[model samples]
Target chain A: MWPPGPRGQPRRVAPTIMNDTLLTVENLKTYFFTERGVFKSVDDVSFTVPRGKTVGIVGESGSGKSVTALSILRLVSAPGKIVGGRVMVSCRGVLQYAPTGTVDLLTLEESEMRRFRGGKIAMIFQEPMTSLNPVFTIGDQIEEAVALHQKELNEAQRWEQVLEVLRLVRIPDPERAARSYPHELSGGMRQRAMIAIALGCRPEILIADEPTTALDVTVQAQVLELLRELRERLGMSLILITHDLGVVAEQADEVIVMYAGKIVEQGTVRQIFSHPRHPYTRALLEALPTFHTTGRLRTIPGSVPSLAALPRGCSFQERCDRVQQRCREEDPELMVMGEGQVARCFFPEL
Target chain B: MGVYLFKRLLLIIPTFLGITLITFLIIQMAPGSPVSLKIQQMGGEGIRTETVSKAVIEQTKKLYGLDQPIHVQYLQWIKRLATFNFGDSYKDHRPVLTKIREALPVTLLLNFISIFLIYLISIPLGIFSALKSRTLLDQAVTVILFILYSLPSFWVAMILIIYLGGGEYLNLFPVAGISSQGVGELTRWGQFGNVLWHLVLPIIVLTYGGFAFLARLSRAQLLEVIRQDYIRTARAKGLSESAVILKHALRNSLIPLITLSGTLLPAMIGGSVVVEQIFSIPGMGKLGFEAVLSRDYPTVMAIAAIEALLTLVGILVSDLMYVWVDPRISFEGM
Candidate 1:
C-alpha cells in the first residue's frame, strides 16, 4: 500500500487508477504565452474517463475541447504550456512510472511521454480528409502507428495487425483499403482509416477529437456506431470531443459541456439532456433544431466569450438570461448535485 | 504510364523540328554563310574577287556545297540527322556529334555534381530553418541565404578564383579547365581526383546560387506543409520530432521541388555560359557560344536541338517525379 499524503491538500494526481476510472485529469490548466499576454486556453478544467465507457467533451469552436484533448497528451505546442495540474494515465507496463503504476503525464519527460503516446493512449484527429498522410497508403500509415509503438511485432505481424484493424473498422477488403491513399478513399472511408490507425496499437485510451465533423451525416452515424462497438469490444476508455450534442446524446455515457475554456456543466448524458442545469447548457439544448420543435431554432443571446478577454465573473454572464449580482462578482465552482452531476452556476436553472 | 510516355514522345518530334527550323532560319537570315566567311578570311585575293577570278569564287561555293537553297539544305540536313549524323562543324571541319560527344559530358558532370550537392545541403537546411521559424536560427539562415543569393555568381566565381586559386592567396585548386596536363598518365582514380581538383572553383560558383534558391524555396514549402492538419496528426501519433518532420512533412514539401525539374537539365547545360567562359572548361555552354560567334550553323543548330530535347524530357521527368512523390498523382487518367 502507498503512504497517504498530508491532509487537506488537493491531490494533483490520484496515485493510480482503480478498476473503474481509467484516466483522471485534475485542475488542468493550459496557457498560451502569446503577444496578447497569457491566454488561459484550458483553465481549471478537470474530468475523468471511466473504464470501458465513452466521455464526450462537448463545446463550440474555440471552447478548448481540442486543446483539452491535446493537453492530456502533453502535445500543447510552442507558445502554449501546461502551466498547472496533472493528467494521470493508468500506467500499465507500457508506461511504468513505478511498481505502483501511475504516471502524471504532465511531469513525464518528453521521451517518456512519447512512449505513453501511441502506445498506451492514441489520438484520432478531426479532418479525417487531411489527418492521414497523403503520400502513404492507408495500410502503411496504420502500420506506422504500430511500428512506432509495437516494437515487439515483426514486419509480417505488423502488416497483419494493420489489416486486422482495417477490418475491425468495417473497411471492406482490408488489403485494398490499406493500399489506398487518403485522397483515394471517400471522406467516410478516410475516417475509418484514421480509426484503424488509432486502434493499431491497441491503446487503452483513444481520444476521438471531432472524428466525424468532416464526414457526411449517414457516414457520421455509421462511424459513431463503429466507435461505440469498438469501445465495447475492446473495453477501451474513449474520449469523444465534438460540437454535436446529438453525437454526445447517442454515444456518451458521461458528458462535459465546456464554454470559454472552462467546463460549465458535467453529468450523465440523460441528466445533461433532460435536466440541464447551467444557463449555457440550457441555451445550447434549446438552440438545437429538433423534429419535435416546429418554430425557428432558438438562438443563444450572444456568442461564446473570447478566452482572451473573459468577463469579470462568469464567462456566460454577458449572455445569461438570469444573470445575478453574485454571478457578476465571481465565478462559481462546479457544485455537485444528484448522482455525480455538477454545474458551475450561481443559480441552477433546474 | 506507357500511354503518357508515348504521348510525350510524340510531342518531341514536332518540338525538335520547330527548334531546328527556327535556329536554321535565324542563322540564314544573318549575312554571310560559312563559305563566304572562309573565302573572305582566305586573304586579299578573295575580298577583291574579280581580280583573282570569278570561277574561283564559284568553285569555292561548289567545294563547300553552299550553292543549295535554304529549303533544299534543310532537307539534306534532316536526311543526315536521320542517319545520326549532325553534320560537320564548318569552323573546325570536325563532326558536330563528335564535338558534342567530347564537350557535353564535362558540362553534364559539373552540373550534375553541383546539383547533387545543392539538394544534399539545401534540403536539410531548409527543414531546419522552417522548424525554427521566428527564431534566431531562422532569421540567420534568411539573412545569409539572401546575401548569398544577391551576390552575382560571376562575381562569386571571380572572388573564389582570386582567393582560393591565385598566387596572392591559397592557390589550392586549379583556376581553369577540368584536368591537369598529365591526367591521362595518372591511374583512373587519380584522373578523376585530378579532374575534381580542377573543378573545385567552378563547382563552388555553380552550386552557390542553386543551393540558396532551393533552400529558400524548400523553407517556404516546408513551412506551409508542417502547418497542415495531417502534420499535427503525425505528431499526435507520438512520432519523434525528426520523424514528424523528415518522414511526414518532407515528402509534401518536396512537391514544389519536383516542379523545378522541368527546367533543371536545360538550365544546367545552357545557363552555364558565364561559368564555363570564366573557367574555360570547354563545356556545351562555351561550345554553343563559340559556335554562334563563328557562324558555325551546324554546331549551333545541333546544340539548340539537344537543349530543346532536354527541356521536353525534363518536363516529362517532372511529371513522373510528381507521380512518385505524391500518391495522389497518378499517370493514369481517371
Candidate 2:
C-alpha cells in the first residue's frame, strides 16, 4: 500500500479500485448488560464501507454511533458486550481465510484480532489532547505502532516509515516534531501526530469517531480536508462518526441517520438529503438552521428515548410529527425502499 | 536541579533551629527535670542520695551549663550544634552523637527492609488486582489487604510477638535486640543472617500497613490511569493487553508513587516507636522515646534537628523526581 516516492511526494489515486465492499457489518447488536436487564445500545444495525469511499454515521449523543465503531475493533469495555453480529473485514490484498474470503472480526482470536487491528483496520478518536501520551515523544508513539504491526520491516525501515507517515499527515519539520512531547505541540499538531500513528501501519480502513469534534471550526475544516486528501492518497475506506450534519454533508459519500440505537434512514448522501424518508431524519434536517432557512431553528418535538426505557413500538413515535396509531401498535422494521436505501418507520415521510 | 538543591540546603538551617527550639521548650516545661531524674537514678544505684542536696544539684547544673538563662543556654546549644556537638546524655554523660550513631543504623536497617518489601510486593499486587478487578482473586486480595491495613501496628506487633516469638506455646526466632549474645563470634554471613532473622517480627509489623496502603492506592490509581484516553489509544494501536498495561499504563500510573518517595526514606529511618519498643531493637525510635522520657534535652534536640533536615531534603528530592517521572513537569521557567 506504500505510495512509491521520496517519502513526502504527493500521490494520486487512480479511481478504478473503489468499487468493492471493503467491510460489511451484518445485523450488529451490541448490548450492554447492566444491573437492569439488557440495554440495546446498537440493535440490529447494518452498514458497509466501500473501498476508497466515506460512510458517515450521524446521530445525537448515545445514538450508538461510537459504539458501532468500537464494536468493529472489539474495544467495547466490560458490562457492554457485542452479543450478536458479524463484522466481516477483508484485508485489501489478501483473503485471510481461504474458503469464505473474509474474516469475522468478532469471532477472531485475540492474537489474530490484534494483528488485524492497526494493520488492516485502524481507529482515531476524539479529544486529541487526552488521546496522546503525555510522557513519550511523538516519534516514539508513532514508532510503537509501526513496530507492533510492520514486523517484516527492520528498525531503520520502520523509522523511515514513521517519518513517511508524519510527512503524509503534513507535519512540518518531522524530525523536530518527533522529538517533541505531546504537550509541546499545539492541539492541531497533536491530532496530526495521532493520525500519523494510526497510519503507521498503513491500514486500508480508518474508523474516525468524531475526529473533528474537539477542534475549532477552522481547524475542523483543515482536519476534514486532511482526511479527505489522505483517503484519496492512501486509497483507504473511512467511516466517520459525527453529530454535525454539516460535517456529514461535506465528507460523507453515504449518510446514516441513527435514532435510539437504530438506523432510521440510510442512503446516498444526495438522495437522503433531498428525499428524507423517516420523520426523525426529516426533523433532524429541519432542526439545522441553513443559510436559506427562515425563522428560528425548527427543533424536534421530543428528546431521544433512553436505551434502557425505549418505546414499545417505534422509538421515534413520541417525537415524530406525522406519527399515526399504527406507529404505536408495532415496532417498525428496516424495509428497503430505493437503490440501496433503507428506512425504519411505519409511515416514512416519502 | 543543582541550584535548587543548593537553595534547599540553605533553607535547612532555619528549619532545624525552629525544630530544636520547640523541642527545648517542651523539655524545659516537661514534668521531670534532668536534675531530679539523674538524682533519682543515682539513689536507685545506691549512691549517696541524702548528700545530693540543692548545693550539689546547682554545681552539677552549672557544670552542664544548664544554670544559665534559658536564652543563653539556647544560644550555646545552637553554637555547639553548628559544630556537630550534640553535648552529652543527661542519664550517662555519654556523647549524644555516639549514642545516636549506634541506634541510627538499626532503625535504618529496619526501615530499609520494610520499604524494600513494601515496594517490591505491593506494586505487582496492585497491578494484578487492578487487572483482575471484580474477579474472585481481586476480591480476596482486597479483603485480606484491607484487614491488614486496618489493624493497628502496635496491636499487630503484640500479636506477632505472642505468636511468632514463642510467647507461650513455642519459641522460633529470638524476640529481643538485633542479635544473640554470641553474634560477634559468628562468621560475617552468620552475623548478617542473625540480624535479619531478629528483624523479621518488627519489619513484618512495620511493612504490612505500608503494603496495604500503597497497594490499594496504586490499584485505584492504575485503574483510573488505564481508563485514560492514551491507554485506549495504546490498545487501539494493536498493542497486546500486557504491553498496553505494562509499557504505557504502568509508568504513568506510578507517578503518584513518586510523590510519596520523599516521605519513604525518612519513615524507614524513623522506625515505629511502639514496634521497636515491643521488639527491643534499640533503633532510633526507641532512642528518641527514652530520651524524651528521661528529659535528655541535648539528645532530644539533636534527633529533632536531624529529622527536620531530612524532611526538607526529602521534599526537595521528591519535587526533583516529579520532573523526571512526568515529562510535562519540567522545572524550566518556574
Candidate 3:
C-alpha cells in the first residue's frame, strides 16, 4: 500500500534507502488501432531497470523498443493504447519522493500519472531540435517542468532550480543558454537543455529514447558521455533505447535485442555480444563490423515482418539463417539458456 | 520598424497615383458623360427635348471640365488630390468629401462590429471543433459551417428579410435602412438600439460567411499546430490538456487567421455591397454603388483611394501582429 496521502503528494523515499530494482515491466502490450490494421508495437515486453544501472534496448525500426519506453511512461497517445501491462516502479530508491512500495503506473489516475511523469521518472526524446518548445526560452521550459512537480518552489526558486539543472547538464553559459530559444542553440546544446528539463525534478529513472540519434558523430559521443556521467552522478537508472550497437557496448550493462515486436534475446552485454543465443541476435552481432571482421559487413537475410501480418510460427523465420522445419512449424517461447540469459528460438545455437 | 513604416508610407504615394490615374482614364473612355445623361433624363421627363441641342451639350461639357484632353483632366484631378480635394459628385453636385465622410462612419461601424463578432465566435468555435475533431459533434459542426459558407450572403439576406424582418411571417425587425424614421427624437441609447435593431439582418448576412470561413481556417491551422512536436513536448511536461492546447497551440495557430485579417481590409472599407443594397443602408457600399451607376467619377475615385490606403495599412498591421504572436519574424531585415 502507498502512503495514505491525497493526490499531488507522492510518498517520500529517503535518498540513502535504495531499492535494488528501480522498475519492473511485466507482460506489457501496447497496440495501435489504426485504420489499416492493429500494430502490435510492444507485445509482451518484460524488463527491469535496476538502480544506478543502464539497460539498453536495441532494435531496428518498428521493433517496439521506443514504444516500450512510451508505454512505461503512459505517454502513448490516441489510437495507441496500452492494452495490458504492469509498469511497477519501486519508490524506495535514490528518489526523494517515490513511495516506500512499488506503484503500478498504468492504473494511476491521469492527475497522479502526471505527477509521476517529470517528477519521479522523466524522458528525453530523440529530436532535440523539436523537443523543446520553440516559443519558450530554455529556462522558461525547464522552469515550467520544475513548477509543475515542485509545487512549493517560488518563481525565483524555480528559476534557480532551472539554472542548477542547466549547470548539471554542463551547459557552458547557463545564463545565456537559459535566455536563448531552442533555435538559438546548437543540436548538442538543445539536447543538453532537454536533459536539464528531464533533470528538473531529480527523477530516479531517465528514459533516453534515441537521445543521440539526431546529433553529429562527435556530438553523439559527447551526449552519450554526458548521459553516462549524469546517471552516475545522480544515481539514476537509465533506459537507453537506440539502434546503435556500438553505443550499447560502450554504455549499457544489460542489452535487449528486439525483433518484430518481441524480444528475441536479452542478456548481459558481454554475454550477448560474445555468445549470442538466438539466430536473430547472432545475425545482428555478425552484422556488426568490428576491426577483426575480415570480409564485407554481414547483412541480415531479410527485414522485419509487418506486425499486422507476421508469419504463423517464428516472426524471424524468414530472416533466420539457421531456420529449420521446427522453427517454421511452431512459435518459440523465451527459454532460459543460462544465468541471466533468455533466448526465443527453437534451435538456439549451442 | 519605424524606418520600415516611413518607407511604406512614402511608397503609398506612387501606388495612389497609379490607382487614381487608371481610374480617371477608364472613366474618360466610358460612354456615359454627365451632359449626355442629363440630356437623356430631360427627354425622358418630357421637358424641352429638342432644345437640349449640341450647343447646350457643349456648354454643359465645358462647365463640367469634361471637354478637356484626357491627360489634362487626369493632371488636374491629381493636382486637386494634392490639396485633399475630391471635387463634387456628378449626381447631386455635393462635395465628394462630405458624402464619403457621412457614409464612412456607417460602413466602419458595421464592418468593425462584424469583424469583432467573427473573431469572438469563430476562434472559440475553431478551437472547440479542433479539440473535438473527428467526433460526431465536430462532424456536425463542420457540416453546419460548410452549409453556412456555401450559401450566398445575398440569398441568405433575402431569406432573413422575408422570415425575420417586416415580412408576412415574423415582422420582428425593420425591413430597410440603418435607423427608424423617428430615431432622432429618442434618447441616445434608444437611438443606438434602434440603429442596431435595423442593422441585425444585414450584419448577420455580412458576418455568417466570414465567421464560417474563418472557423474552418482556424480549425485547420490549430490542428496542424497541435500535431507539431512542441505540443507533444508540452504534454510530456505534465501540463494538462487545456494548458497544452490553450497556451502552447493557440498562439502558433493564429498566424493564418492574422493573414486573413489583413486581406479583409478592402472588404471592411468597401462594405458588403449587396447587403447594404438589400437593407438600403446609407453605407459606403451603397454610396459607391450609386456613384458608379451615375458615373460620379470623383466619388468613385475618393472611395477607391481610401480603400487602397486602408488595405496597405491593414497589411502593415497584420505584419506587426505576426511579430507579436511569433518572435521568429522581425521587420528589421525587410
Candidate 2 stretches with Cα past 4 Å from truth are A1-19, A94-100, A293-295, B1-7, B45-51, B166-168
What would the per-residue lDDT of candidate 2 be over residues A1-350, giving only the tens digit for each residue?
23221344432212233348888898999999999878899999899899899999999999999998999989998789999979886544733322223567887778767876887789999999999988899999999999987777898998888889999999999989989999998888888899999999778999999999998888889989999999999999999999999899889999999888899899999978889898888888888888898878988877887799987789999888788898888998988879988899877776
State TM-scores per candidate: 0.93, 0.93, 0.94
True contacts kept of 2: 0.77
Please give, for residues B175-196, the per-residue lDDT of candidate 2 as tens digits.
8899999899999999999999
In model 2 chain A, where is the ten-residue run with the lowest total lDDT? A10-19
What fraction of the reference interface contacts is present in each model, in order? Answer: 0.78, 0.77, 0.43
Q: Estimate, for each residue in B1-334, the C-alpha lDDT of model 3 and write its tens digit.
A: 8898788789878887887778777877888877778888998899887887789888988988989988898888888988999999988999999999999889888888899899999999999999999999989999998888899988998899889876588989887898988789999999999999988888898888876788988899999998787777777777888889888899789876876687685776565888888889998999999898888888988888888778777877777777776656677867
RMSD of each: 3.8, 5.2, 3.0
Best-first order by DockQ: 2, 1, 3
Q: How well docked is model 1, in DockQ terms?
A: 0.72
lDDT (CA) per prediction: 0.86, 0.86, 0.86
Q: Interface root mean square deviation for model 3, in Å? A: 1.3
Model 3 residue pairs with clashes: none
Q: For model 3, what is the alpha-carbon lDDT of residue A293?
A: 91
Measured over the true interface residues after superposition, the C-alpha RMSD of each candidate is 1.0, 0.7, 1.3
Candidate 1 residue-wise lDDT, B242-276, digit = tens: 88889889988999797686668788888788899
Which pairs of residues clash in candidate 2, taking residues 3 or more apart in a chain or in different chains?
B166-B170
Candidate 3: fraction of native contacts reproduced:
0.43
